[model samples]
Target: MPRSNWVSRVVGWDRPRREQPAWLHGDRQHLLPTHSHTDRHVVSTIPAAQVTKVALKLRHLVESAVPCDLDESEITRAHSSIITPEVVQAAKEAGGSEYRACVVFCLLICKAWFRQQSVVELWDADLHRGREVACEVIAKKLIETEDDTSFLLHNILLQRYSILVDGEPTYPANAIERAVDLHAVDVITSSGYQKCVDHLWRGWLVQDEDNPTTFVDYANRDKISFFTHLDPDRIRVPRYQNATQLLVTIAFLVLFTVAVNTPNPSGRLDVAEVLLYLFTLGFICNEVTKVYKAGYRILGFWNAVNGVLYTLITASFVLRMVGLGQPLDHGHEDPAHHREFYRTLSYNFLAFSAPLFWCRLLLYLDTFRFFGAMLVVLKVMMKESLIFFALLAVVIVGFLQAFIGLDIVDDMAVDEYGVIIKAMANAVMQSPEFDTFGRFSPPFGTLLYYFFTFIVMVILLNVLIALYNSAYEDIYQNADAEFLALFAHKTLQFVRAPDENVYIPPFNLVEIVLIALFGWWMPAGRFEQLNDAVMSCCYAPVMVAAAAYESNVARAIHRNRARGGSGDDYDDVVDHEWERVACAPETQVDFEAEGWDKVCEAAKSDIEVEPAVQEVRQLRAEVEELKRMLAEISRAVGAAAAGEESK
Candidate 1:
């Protein structure tokens, strides 16, 4: 059967269908002469069947060459598709057979042109406009594709077409052009006949006058509708998901209250205080930036505001340094001003390091730095912002309280005030390092200073770090569980036959809320009930899964080692770390060197790690606690029953 007959049969020739006979004449490498433009004058004298076969083969070359089934799902599931005729024609001409190849082509093309302004123009127009505009504009650009086309044209044509030679060819003028466009010029290597490429030199192929542009457009409907939903596939997220996200964001934002404060002494703003303010403004800007669609329009003002705050704080630091006669250069750095200048420089540099890149000339680079730096700032501000601000406020309000109680600085000296300010500053940097020492050292401080610092940095930090670390870990850990659920959903699709219209996967609201309700947390109890039952249920499965994964990895490594394969394929350090991470027992790892000799004698490197070292950290704690409780219970029971028997 001829290739044209197949399409004719599939589309069902409305008037009448007929079978057309055809035969494969030549391969891609071989050349068989056909006919010229003048030869076509006598084409009718040749077999009518041969002409039909050629037309059919050409149609197949156009349709089956470019596959586009790659993103059929995207079209079916997008927030109302905005398909243009260019997209439609490309897909149709490409046909379903070449879907994956076309997708790869589109990806390659987008990768190449993403930074080009013209691509943005094309995308915006294609994504937003009516089909009518796209067809005309796309046709013009389609011509330009001759110059900047995706590699698909070459790859596809190479798969389908053959070079012709030997006899007089009766090829269509357009077909010759198509051959040349596909670089079939390799067919002609003879001397001085690149010009005899005559009848084959057609430059354009006409598009089907009637073609599908916007395959289906529902760009105007609300995404998810609980009442009269037409298509769930078109909606990206679930109906109530927006509400869940909004509430969650609000809860997170409310934690910012921890950072608020009163004021500085002299009722004036100070450098650290202003820096904290700029940090807050930047955070709010970051939250607004989290919005995907409206980030630019709605958050633009906040971005500007954040930029101003940074500039002002930087300027204030410079002005203050100038007022104190600190060195702007070597001229002002004499002994009289050297200490002040160094202190001022250190303070300003630490505070403003993230903002120096904010100039419009380097805005993109600044934006990249800003987001990461802001996240760190958010963490710092969430816990200490309140304390910091409160201290600031106390600086203002505390003086008033003391004044009302008849305290006066007028009679006292400047050093007294300096001592008070210095005390507050010293109280800010304490940490776990301080836990080792009962008292302060030379560079450390007095009992009072360390005590206040301990309250602010050490003790409060233990309390807050315990809280934040627990929350962050819980959320981070649950992310894997969500991925597991998605994996399960996909696996289920393969296991069971499903209706195409049915959604195989359920909505994925980050299960942080449900996990919260279950009381499986960092400290394991603050938010919900103090029930270890719930905690065990939540954590046990993850632990079991982790154990299984570690066992498999250990097996793979041992197998690789036994085969005498290149261990170079694996990073020994990374593998060691992974074992420390993935298979490391919940028990604390033993850093103690007591078992070094015994470990060296072990056959497998993995087995060399003392299991006790890992398990002992956790199990020891529990077992010890259990033993104590059981002893106490035994005593209580013995005492109670004895008293009863004696009575």
Candidate 2:
């Protein structure tokens, strides 16, 4: 059957039904080339000469390819027949700037002009072999330009059309093949792919040398952090590594607790007091750096929590220092009581601050991505369940109001706070007041109690559970991306590391204050500054070198393969780092090093039969359609089963 007939059959089934064809929806109407120019009349009177001028200007703009200018919709209107195949063909043959401009224009028509709808629709609708012509022009222009436009074109086609230029399943578009190409375009070229990876890695590594004004612009730091994995060894301050800082901070917190709890003989300044001052100074400095780098608004929920914790810890330390050795005589009956009051205040502050210190563990979420993903899932669940919680709150409040109006809240010994709390407890039959519901006049209280209990405990709670489960499932589906994004953000926090000497365990406190007051002026010459910037980062240079080495090797391999030399010819020049990274127990294996072997394996795995799996799937689909047609014809012709006559 023809493609149109299949669409017609599918269209017939699109009557307010579940799982209807996507074209039935307005959002997907662009997938069909039969688009109604609703606003055509407004532009119809515009002269073709004027339209052509606009089209040529747009072509120049596309060729120049300014990122900000790409979003402008002015050029989209000039995508009429004025910029036809002949124009694109002539532009291609001319082979100057016109070649690249024409390619981008065609891509704009295929992707951006139609709001990124299906490009194959052009061929499906028999729009003058648009798909075939576009592919040829694109390929020719790609050879001529050899620019990043090829990346964009390849991404659009592979992502939107499932059409790989050099690979199998080459294009002559199919509806089923189009449905499955949903993943983002992260890789482009087979050769020098390692260079792409290295570029991405280096770009992600937020540097101290980066200009604060242009950092965001140069780095594209605003993108979702989920794609790049952070390396702690490569991205850390001079003295304090990520794990070391975490451990030392934990030790300081512990010492602070010990100092508070232990009795101080003769009331002398102890280890705890010194530790307190150092921790306070370091915490304040660290937080200030974070705010300066990213601004406070970009800080996460946990960052805010950490801020509160730091404040409490600082206040408690300040209070301890202030109260120490001071005679409590001003308007105080008992000095002991006054001393006890400040002690209690400081203790309370430290106690509240202690639990929040554990939030620092969230920084290492990249190491344990599963737990990070769970936290994300919980966050999503909480966000989704808020409305449900509010609805439940309203119902519970209504029940409480009814109880108070009847003056029965007092009978249950439930106060204002207890009304909300104890009512919920009673709903679950967990409160003593649950048994006294029948004591009300007539059956009003009993009816209300059961109704509230059923609605709140059974119905609403179940609804919340369902909502949470749905959210968790959604998060789980995209857990990898979510977790990676978290890791990426966490890595950014480490980018702007302190230049001060590494704070040694107990001595770091005194050193912190010294560094604050004097470290800036204590700097050496240009060599020292360069050393601090480049060599101070322990693993960063090594990582970059490894990537560079791999990229070179990849280029060499590609060069050899291109010249018809065996890939084995270049295998003798072994990369130790590549081997280490590949063989490591925990590290992700890079497919680039393996090159064509990985690609061949992937291609083999994609095969369902020894021949083309796509062809097999397509044939199977057609056979099923034929079977369905035969059955329908038999039913319509009122034919008896041949098996019955044989029997």
Candidate 3:
């Protein structure tokens, strides 16, 4: 067998052949009874081809009725007429699968709209509106179904497939990628999607209420909530988790500051120092676990910052320990200097890392919309700057080599390499040192230096500026989409590694001990029970506060519903007016009126050319008919001649 086939068999992609059983032998098989399976327990699945066909028909209907120039009202009407509640319900009923056919239908329609937007010269607002309506309908359905529709929203919709287009496989992209590409932030950030994510996060660590002994897949014992009775409802929110992490980080920073600044004449460990040591150990453990869980993803920019921060702190602590262990008096002339040297080095390392600690606060602060959006812009800019830096590096290396070659005449007197590097760097900073280069190689050196300055200052600098501006403009133009994408990405990060539980730093230190003692040998039920008891005690205050807030919100919603009012009352007239201004008629073009004639002219031309092509085909058919008649005549004449000759 081929290696590929063998590997496939090993992985069970190609099922291995099974030997026939004795019971299935001719006589035995006839005597044995057979059982029939019922459809009642089996889920009905709609074929992918049928779903795609229905989606295409729906797409054609929307496209034909609502052109790019159609008004919002007309577009809404067209979408509403096609994607009616009846149609959605029928699709849902047809598929008894966990990933309902209706969701797949909506996703396909959205994907079609996205593809159109990418291919067209001008984006159709009406098409966009149609997509938005479809998304709204999807959101409504998802919310109504709640956890039941989770498989489609969280798994199937997000699964990438290599779809063939025009007989070749195209790049794989999931629903999230399509939405991001189309700048349809409304879909990913929809209340429905958020609720789905929350459901997934909450279920990350859950217990079986009825059967405690039954093991729950994807359950994390570390994330066991204080109130497991409430299960998902009272599970810790990601935002709350971030907030708690921020508090812990702040506490860690404060402890470090106090520990370093406090005097220790006797070289004995103080309370602050011990507490700081514990915090550092917890942070180190947390980072290690994150790296272990996240793998290569922990190599991102922020994680690099964290790695550096922790490295410095760990080294500083080590140096401090060594310094404390040194004897106060020695046989040397300056006895105290030896110990002071180590202490000074340790303090230097700790002080040097203060800026990084402050910078790390931004990581947690990103939960806020303003900070999150700004971080997205910053991340884009950093990625864009890589291009600039790569080009600059090549330019600098080329110039350095040229300068070195020119300085071969006077090798001993001057450090040509250092001079050239400083000159190039200064030129990049808009400050040129032309005089130093002029004395070394005379005219050629001066000329080269001038060229370098112009290239660095005028050309490369402007290119970098242009790149930054382009990135900034692109992000700001679709600011909402960019922010929502960032938000969704952040939200997914929490639940991506389902096995890694939520043990915020210092608490993780405690979790480490418990895992070692009980995690290995204990039964799943007993282990979960242990985690629940520990979490309830450790997070009593937080759980109580969260429960109270939830109760208040629930009561408010119920009261509003009873009074016939919308649950939310935080709407502002200013926001409403702003939305109106944004979508006003004056701000938009009436493409239907302006471009209708052009469309008609193009259609007429196509119509004219189509008939001419038809005529050519018709003439070809006539010629073929004439040839056939001639062949028949020739055959008949040949037959007659043959008969005459025989007579």
Worst 10 residues of 3 by lDDT: 26-35
TM-score of each: 0.21, 0.46, 0.60
Clashing pairs for model 2 are 226-484, 226-485, 239-502
Leading candidate by lDDT: 3
Q: Which lDDT tens digits does candidate 2 get at residues 1-647? A: 11222222222221121121232111121111110121111121223233234334444433433222222222222232333345445544432442232332233333222222224354333322332233323333333344452343233221222122223212122111121121111111112222222222334222223221011112322222322223232333212244455566667667767866774533345777666656666666655643543344435555667678778877876666666645655567865545555655766787777667666555444447777887787667767778787997788778767766555534543335554457566665534355555554437767878788878777887888898989888878767756655443343233322222333334334444443444444443542343334333533543454344445555654555665554332342344578658656798655678596677777774432334666888899999999999999988665556656667
Q: Point out where model 3 deviates above 4 Å.
A: 1-186, 189-191, 194-235, 263-274, 329-337, 407-409, 416-423, 435-439, 499-501, 564-647
Each model's number of backbone clashes? Answer: 23, 3, 0
Per-residue C-alpha lDDT of model 3 across residues 349-404, encoded as one tens digit per residue = 88888898888888888767788877877888888999999999999888888788
Q: Write the per-residue lDDT of candidate 1 for residues 530-574, one digit (tens) a residue.
A: 223333343343334333433444455455565554322223213
* Reference-based TM-score, model 3: 0.60
Clashing pairs in 3: none
List ranges where model 1 is wrong by over 4 Å: 1-416, 431-451, 480-647
